[model samples]
Target: MGRGIVKVWYDPEGDFLEVLFEKKEGYFRETSDDRVMEKVDMQGHVIGFSVLGTRNLAKMPLEVALS
Candidate 1:
């Protein structure tokens, strides 16, 4: 058994980002979503991950976020 997951990867040529949504274990099932990728810089201490909004995506820094 495995955990459910979503993955984000860089797309340099398209100038956009790729998102992969997957249901873990059992069947090999996965799909992708197209998103405009950008970088996010955190203040204070960078903690665990949180859900992001459209506005948050817009505010991120392209250089760092792509990683």
Candidate 2:
């Protein structure tokens, strides 16, 4: 485990949300859910995640495995 600041961002116009556990280069990949994406480094460790259609979450809670 590592200790560091976690970053969160939300775009009202896009209805999207993103969270980052580490500040580094990574690429987003598909997860079990289509609305969710996991960002991973070259080594495949989960560094962050993003959510699409965030505004719809109010009607149904989002649930998806990161790794």
Candidate 3:
């Protein structure tokens, strides 16, 4: 598979962080945690992820897995 561009967007004002693996047609969905969410394409491949609280990340356990 061809590799896609990766992009990271952080909204300081909103305290949100988004890491995009591929910029394509996709939608965001909430993961198990309320502070985390992921984006998936039509084929069900994860394209990106978002975190609600970025500043407090250091205080909590952080692990990213989509399975």
Candidate 1 to truth, TM: 0.27
Residue 3, model 1, lDDT: 45
The best candidate in terms of lDDT: 2
Error of 1 at 58 (Å): 3.8
Residue-wise C-alpha lDDT for candidate 3, range 1-67, written one tens digit per residue = 2376678899999999998888789888878888888999988889889999889988986786764
Ranking by TM-score: 2, 3, 1
Q: lDDT: which is higher, 1 or 2? A: 2
Poorly placed runs, candidate 1 (over 4 Å): 23-67
> Which residue segments of model 2 deviate by more than 4 Å?
none
Ranked by TM-score, the better of candidates 1 and 3 is: 3
Over 1-67, each residue of candidate 2 has an lDDT whose tens digit, in order, gives 2578889999999989999998879899999889999999989999999999988888978889888
Worst 10 residues of 1 by lDDT: 24-33
TM-score versus the correct structure, for each prediction: 0.27, 0.90, 0.85
The collision pairs in model 3 are none
